[model samples]
Target chain A: MAEVEISQLHKTYPGGGRPATRDVSLTVADGEFMVLLGPSGCGKTTLLRMIAGLELPDRGSVRIGGRDVTYRAPRERNLSMVFQSYAVFPHKKVADNIGFGLAMRKADRAVIQDKIAWAAGLLQLEDYLDRYPSQLSGGQRQRVAVARAIVMEPDVLLMDEPLSNLDALLRLQFRAELKKLLTDLGTTCVYVTHDQVEALSLGERVAVMKDGEIVQCGPPMEVYDSPASEFIGGFIGSPPMNFLDATLRRDGGEAVIEVAGQRSAAPGSWAAFAEGPVRIGVRAETITAHRAERSGALRAVTEVAEPLGSTTLVTAVLGEQRIKVQVPPDFPVGAGDDLWLDLRADRLSCYERDTGRVLVSDR
Target chain B: MTAAGTAAPDRAAAPDAGVDRAPLARRRRNRMLVQVACLAITAFMAAPMYLITLAAFSTRESLNAFPKSFAPADVSTETLRSFLGATGVVPSFLNSLVVGLLTLVLSVAIGTPAGYALARHVFAGRDAYQLFLLFTRALPIVVLSVPLARFFITAGLSDTVLAVALLHTALALPTTVLITASIFTAVPRDLEEAALVFGCTRASAFRQVVAPLALPGIAAASLFTFVLSWNEVLGAAVLTLTNRTLPAQVLGSLQWSPLPYRFAGGFALLVPALIFIFVMRRYLLNMWGTTLR
Candidate 1:
């Protein structure tokens, strides 16, 4: 197993348009589960295809395990991939599908059998070895596809949304299984997925890509909490971070943000940005019900209350703006009634509304 | 819907209504009438063939009889041997086999690649290239055969099996290409991509992955080309006189020639079709599916 380094890769299609994957650079450490997460057409799959050597880059080099394999063919790269469509050979039995690569190298019959058995057993696909892909269910076909790639035991395992076809419950369950299997195998994997939750749960480090470039890359929680920019803050969460326009000021040893109807105290970091109207982002869970008349804060009238059993989602209107809050399930708030939103100044991230950048000190 | 469109399916479906659960007598009679009509048409085609076969095997007296025997009432190998002894019937049969096999090989070699390209590749002249193939296939062989034969004779290739095979390959090229193109299109693009990612080169992926999967189709296409070559008389007759293919040999024979040769020649033609059709039986669904599409 070895780390894969894609340095300044540019993949311009032969038709001569914008590069599908631009000057993108990211590393998948040895035995690291690195997820390339982005929406469709964001170049995640293109990058993975380049790593697998199925697609060639117009510029830059790809080093796998310290060896430059940029111009090499996929077979020479010693990488196996499980495609999003679960590319199991429809005509072949599950055993045949898993044993195909081994057969290609003309491995010993006993060795091929052992490898097929081992891979099939790991995937819980022993009973279906004799069955064709058309005879198997969606999840079962996907498992066979995974088993086929894993049987090769390549230096790197590339997966392109291998669980996207399964139904909701199956997807979640198989995703957990997939993570465990990858971890147990100790294979370095570069996975591409669009689902943020899947990325968070599967990757040791998630690289968020946009427009053929890596916008942010960090551990799941670090990227979730300390978002580097407005895009990161906007993209990381479920309902997404809510942003409201407010003028910043420092009055008597306290940083304050004054909206149209109320004035709220800010975190200490907001002092450097005490200028004109800026965007303040609050996580849905950050704005809790502040009914006790707590000092050094502001209040907003709750416009809509969505109680989601374990937590309540309250979209409180701050004059012309809307700020979402994830409060305790038992928060005393309802629609049309005024509710207090106690946004802790620390959790409220400030951004330049005009430029859409983080309004924080360099430190 | 227009009256014509509405009535079309109803007219098509009317005959089959007899198979309805507990079909009424009138419906069954209508169905029987349609079946009888179909049977009559089949007989219309097969009757001459049956008569020819009977006249071929029978003595001269049988040829001048009132009506022909439907079955091989007095089947004999005597006429077979006499036909085999006729002006180089054995060599002509072998020549036909050689030409047919050659045609099948060349057409498949050229057509399958063109088919795969047309199916998968998007090139600058792709549509125009396809239109070219369409026009080439639609060109009547009658307009080209005499000139082509003359060209072959001048080139010192006339009356050779190679000349006939080349001519047959040209005739069968478009049909073979179109057949295999439809076949390859049914295969998914993702499968090929997956194979590529697994380290197979484009050609290897095609050979090891796609070609095996498309075997049924390719085989069918080759068989079709083979049949076209075997059955073609016009080009084969003109292109090769000495090493005449079976159809050329049969057509070269005089109208009043021994009836036995007609029976044997017709029987020889029937053999390849029987074999070719049997070979395609497994892929009947494939042909049907293509038709549906």
Candidate 2:
């Protein structure tokens, strides 16, 4: 296995008005699984392609296994990639497709045969070894593509939304299998995806990107619990973290936050910021709803209630802002009902109203 | 209101069966019409081949017989035998085959790379170059062939099969390039990139992935080039004397020859082109949609 070190990569298409990637730098340690997660057009794919040497960066350096290969061709980079389209050669059988890299390297015939069998077994594609890609189902073709890449045993494996093309159940099953297989093999991987759940589940570390720049990089749980900015908070979660307009004030060295005519204690770190208009960001599951009025609890009128099997998502109007709160599925709530919301002080994130930057210290 | 609501559905349901039956009947009629049209087109295309084959194989006296019989009666090969026995016919036929095959090779070899560039790259003047190819065809062959003949003589390449093949390659290139470009475009770019990532260089990737996928299309272009070179008379006639292709050699004599010999010559020219199309029909079908799932 090899570590991939990339530094100060920049690229802009000739006719594109904005750059695709802006001074992006990242490193994946030996045998580490790193995922670059973002929405479409955020340059995650561009960054991965640069590392694979499929695309040359306008200005940057990429070193794989301590060898500078920024200007090298993709073949010279000693890497393999699985595309979202599962680009298995339609003309070749599954066995030949998996053995293509070894054949290109002029490996021994017996070695190529052994490697094909091993990869086929790993991908559960032993039965499909003689089938062409055109004859296989979408999921099977994708497995063939993965087998093709892993059979190469290259320095690094790059995947660009490889599971995005599969159906929901197959994608979930394959995602879990892929995580286990890659972990067992200990191959250095740099994967790009727009799906948050895939990043959270498959990656040992997730690097979140936006507008062609890496916004935050950390363990998935840490990034989920303590996002670096409002964008990261809103982008990373389902029923994304709700942001409500509030005011922060200092009261006897304690941080007091006022929202919708109710005052509550805020996180201690918020005390460092000057008293001004701020936004209080809280996750959907962190807020509790009480039927009766309570001291220090903000009043809200519920607008919609959607029961999602395990949890009920309640959209409530608090003053002029709309916020979503996840409650127990059995919680009795509906539109037009008045509820007092208690935002968890420790879980609350304070953000600047004008800049959307987090006002509190990084956790 | 409840009675009227119930009555309205009943009224609607009563006509539903008739509505369905009307559409079914109309569909049947439309299918019949389509079949009739197809038969008409097929007959229109096949009639000439039928008449040519009949005339070429018939006895020589049958050509002058009044109220000619469409049905085969005296199916002697006398006319065809005499036609083949004529001086220079066999030699010219061989020359035509050489010129056709040579043109096919030269055009595809030169035009495929240009087509690949047009399909895969975004270099400057790309659109203008494509337009220039089309504009080359707009210049009349009749206008260009005389000067071309002179140029060939100056280059010491006149009156040769290679000279006619060169002229045919120039004539066939625009169509060949355009057709092959579209073929290459249909091949997904991801397959090529995947090959590159799997240790194949750009050239090898194209050879292994793109070329096999593009074979059917290249075959179609070759078929067009071969037939065009085989049948072209004006350019071949102007450029060659003793090395004339079959069409050029026959066109000069067939106008003064008797009617049966003319029919025999026409059948000879038609046979090779038909065989070529027969050979390439499967690849042409592949180009239409049966490839790559």
lDDT of each: 0.83, 0.90
lDDT of 2 by residue, A102-170 (tens): 999999999999999999999999999998888899999999999999988989999999999999999
Error of 2 at A24 (Å): 0.9
Tens digits of per-residue lDDT for model 1 on A323-349? 788888887888887767677777777
Q: Supply fnat for every model shown.
A: 0.71, 0.92
| Local lDDT at A93 for model 1 | 90
Candidate 1 TM-score over all chains jointly: 0.84
Q: What share of the true interface contacts does candidate 2 keep?
A: 0.92
Model 1 DockQ, alpha carbons vs. true complex: 0.52
* Tens digits of lDDT, candidate 2, B30-101: 766777788799999999988999999999888889899999879989999999999889999999999999
What does candidate 1's lDDT look like per residue over B127-166, in tens digits? Answer: 8887788788677777888899889879999889999899
| Model number with the top lDDT | 2
Candidate 2 versus the native: TM-score? 0.94
